[model samples]
Target: MLAFPRPASSAFYRPDIDGLRAIAVLSVIAYHIGVPGLPGGFVGVDIFFVLSGFLISGLLRQELLATGSLGFAAFFARRIRRLGPALMLVTLVTLLAGYMVLLPDAANTLGREARAVVTLSANHHFMKHAFDYFNTATDLKPLLHTWSLAVEEQYYLLWPLLMLGAYRAGGGEKALRPTLLAVLLLSFAACLSLSYSDMPKAFYLMPARAWEFAAGGLLAWLPLRHSRSAWHANALAGGGLAILLCSIVLLDEHSMVFPGWVVLLPVCGTLLVLAAGGLDPHHAPGRLLGSRWFTALGLLSYSWYLWHQPLLALGRYYDVGQRDLLRDFLLGGVLALFLAWLTYCLVEQPVRQRRWRCFATDKSTLWAGLAMSVLVWLVASAAMYMPKKYPWPGYQAILQVKQDQAQLPPGCDMPERGVPLSPQASCRIGPAHAPLQLLAWGDSHTDHAMPMYQLLAQAQGVGILRRAYHGCPPLVDAVPVGEGKVRSWCLNHSRAVMAELASLSRSGLHGVLMNVRWNGYTALPVAGSASITGLAQADAQGNVAVAGAMLAGVGQLDRAHSLQVMAASLDRVASQLAALRLKLVLLAPEPEMPLSVPECLARRGAAACHASRADVDRQRAAILPILQQVASRHANVRVWDPIARFCDAQTCYAAAAGVVRYQDQNHLTASMSRTLQADFAPLFSWARQP
Candidate 1:
């Protein structure tokens, strides 16, 4: 057996650990800032989890081995000193920034999140509110990054107690090894299970995350034997680092369910590096990690993590230039580094090092920490309720847009589960006595475009039947499955709706106005839980599993494959409708804005509240071709492009005539949708006649 060096017994600073810290923080920053070729940069938080477990467990193990007991108060005091001051400082600054730059709704959110940060409950708060960490909307939240810190703190609260219990259970430090191993196994099992079942719980809760810490804690107890050669140690550390690099390269936000099976790569990698270096800091990995630059960045990692997100998010919120994302992040990074240095030097170093005798002891540190936390909490509470009192310029206009944003009238859209295809009285959009001539079919996009349909129905004196299942596109064989909670209902609803199309045609329904967000269905699938509308292919016997093939154990279909599947489905559906003498009018996709129009207007005002026409065109480049090809194939099928109505040559304006045009990123507001009657007149006239 190759002898691996045992860790040194005596306590000493490990520069290599600092280097590792530097790597973790930088990876996170790079990921958040949209750094290219580093989509898996989020794995940095998992790395931090392991590092914290190892260091904290090692410290407790050392104390138990020497003194046979733990000093709970002293440990917590040290932690408070290390974490509290810098957090309070950042929260205060973020709060002031919120007050100055944000609208009432956004300011209130910042205030609420600020309280959660100071109270160390940010993980729970964000878990409830922010469903997906990778969601684009979450990029606007400055305090969102604090959830990881909350997880670490929550783990520390229970970990030392477990260590103390294990120490008292006999066999001295050896007892801790088994206890940590048990925790590692059990917590990992729970994490794996919940990642599939309840992702938010798995992601944000400490229980599901405890295994990562336990893996690090187990590293602290690994028995080491001194070896003559360093080659094996170098190989082990190199292999570990190679694994981490692979993870960073291969994984992304939607690559896999986060902190699931894939997380083991980073956890194992971190363990390998720490295991090899803990015994001898002279190993190749150690020497590289302990270099001056790595150590310096490591020293500033905590403060940098705290400062960067707020600066970036606030910068985005206040930005009017609509500059390139890379440029925005680059500028934000410089500002964040400067602020982090000031925070580290002015607040973190002074408090943690106990520069004055009065603040030197554990008691003083705890009291000061408590006072600071209270101050933050009070200020956050004030900011929460104070937003309405201080209105910004054009606040009333923004407020009206916020209050009166468009939605499909109640009872019109399908519920999450089960197929409810029957239309109610409210679902018909025309004079009650007028004959129902048209079917408005699609997903949420159709729901958003209802006002235009309603206006046309009333003007043309024809009833339009509204049939919309949220997230389920208008397709026959392509069923939406995987990821979202609504998938089950979507499949059932889609199947039922498609099956009823012939019945509708027999009952005098003449045309189908199909308008869905085509980009979502056609986008390439990554290796994650992002559900897509999949094409169900049949086996040899002409047998098809409406719920089986493509959805069972299959992730989303790739972009080209998905588009192919959708085009085939559209062809079949259009052909079927054409044979039934039903006119098929395919509404070309509306330009999707980069952000919520109302939210953008409230924050950046009217001048800056629009998306680049070039960017919109780029987004739709893949979608338009398939739609055009599908529409051109059938005599009765035609495509209607509304790009000219909503957009000029240069821009797709979010608001027009001081009214917000979009309710969110893609969906049009009722006011804006109503203004599109001129655009929809020809289609409505044709459908009514047919």
Candidate 2:
């Protein structure tokens, strides 16, 4: 085993250590860029963690031993001096970019993300969006990099107290070693466990990250001093460097996690290199790290890290062409280094030398920067509070995102929607005690099809009752797999609705109308998880599990559902209506508008970009089949597809011939659904004639 020896000096800043910094940061930048033979370059941050823990703990330990107490104010002041300026600058840049580039929906998300970044809660923001990544829009927020700063901020808040308590409770410098060792062991155990149980959470947050810092703490507290043989130093340095290289160049996919036990390769490798610091100058790799060039990059590592991500991210965002990705990555890398050199040589050195001393070290200055960050975050959040009103440019691209987010039909989620009031609880859609009772029951898709039903009811002179939820499909015969608990609740609820409908039908209710996202029943496991629900037999990774309920993932990707359950339910409802001699007319699914009515207006007004023909075709095919089937079967059932009114060979406009067609993806905005039905009112008018 090797050990790290600390000399009794607070100012022992080593240039060779800075060279090691070059190794760690370059590895991370390389891995993110997907450079050849460097798939595991991310592990380099682990190496940095170990180095940081050892170095910072070493400084704090020396401070405590000499002064008998930690300078809490001074420590935080130093941190502010080091981090606050750059962070504030970056947040401003991010907010400015968000305002200029993102759509209203996307900008609203950026606003939410800005608060997370300012508050250091970005890890939580991403975790919540994890399950919704496919249909949900991906990150457009520029401040995403602040997740690391949040981790660091959390660490700074809690770590000093822990160290102070350990030192004071031990009563002397001698007790420091044992206390740190114990803490390291315990923290490492927890980190190891989290690496297995909940890797994503562990990887994203700073809790598991504490152990990487602890590893460095352990090295700083080692009992023995450095004593490396020439042969040993060469062999050990070579072996450790090999492991570091392996971690940087090879690890890929989702096999292991960062800040976990697997991170030990780079962490321990960094420690091993530290062990050889007192080695013979003849040792090869030591001389390599000792070189002036590597040390310069190491000294500049902090600036390099700050500059790289945003630069590359902006290029990727714009999809800039530069031959192949390698050429683009290299160009980005060169630009990053130039900016890093500028920041270090110009900003960092000048500040450290007290050239800008007044603002640089002042308490009020940090407070001001923090206040500015808070103000930006709050402004962004207020914008999010009503994001649609903002005149953001890219919103047309994300209107589909709003539509794609139309999971389930309507209602039917956690708290329940469109449920009927208890019989004792009176709620009416129209005037009470009308001459004819009209009951409308189904999903939000039913809500969208409502205006047509309303027209028919009006022409026939009857009242309308509505009951439906977004995700709850109309299943009559069999229980859906996947949603064991949910299926039970929904089945009981649907049974209750049908039973109530039975009473009304028997009571001589004039008509019964129903509608649903029918393809909601046939979701395939592969390409269709977003469109349909409760039926995807397998997931995106080919695992057998139903994904969310949406229109995109309808029917089967593999094994088939005759969907006998849904078909039977429709037949049963139809038979009931026929028996009651109620006028029964089913709407053939209306063709989906390529854009929501609002988005179409924006594009026409030159406020947004239009979607591709491919998007329209994909949506059009989604509901075509069920619409055809409902029209052909029951003689009393009438299907109505308004494709003729809104679509042409060239395109399907969200609004056509002055008719505003949709509120959102499929639900009619209450106003648009009601008003637009006037043109299609004749079909319902004809259907209800006795």
Best by TM-score: 1
CA lDDT, every model vs. true structure: 0.76, 0.57
User: Candidate 2 versus the native: TM-score?
Assistant: 0.64
What is the TM-score of each predicted model, taking all chains together? 0.75, 0.64
Candidate 1 residue lDDT tens string, 26-124: 888888888889999889898899999889888888888899999988998889888888888889999988887777888999999999988899999
Question: Which model scores highest in lDDT?
Answer: 1
lDDT of 2 by residue, 478-506 (tens): 33442111234445456566667667666
Q: Stretches of candidate 2 above 4 Å error?
A: 1-11, 30-45, 129-139, 192-199, 223-227, 253-283, 286-297, 307-339, 359-690
After TM-score superposition, the amount by which residue 510's alpha carbon in candidate 2 deviates from its true location, in angstroms, is: 12
**Per-model tally of clashing residue pairs:** 3, 21
lDDT of model 1 at position 402? 57
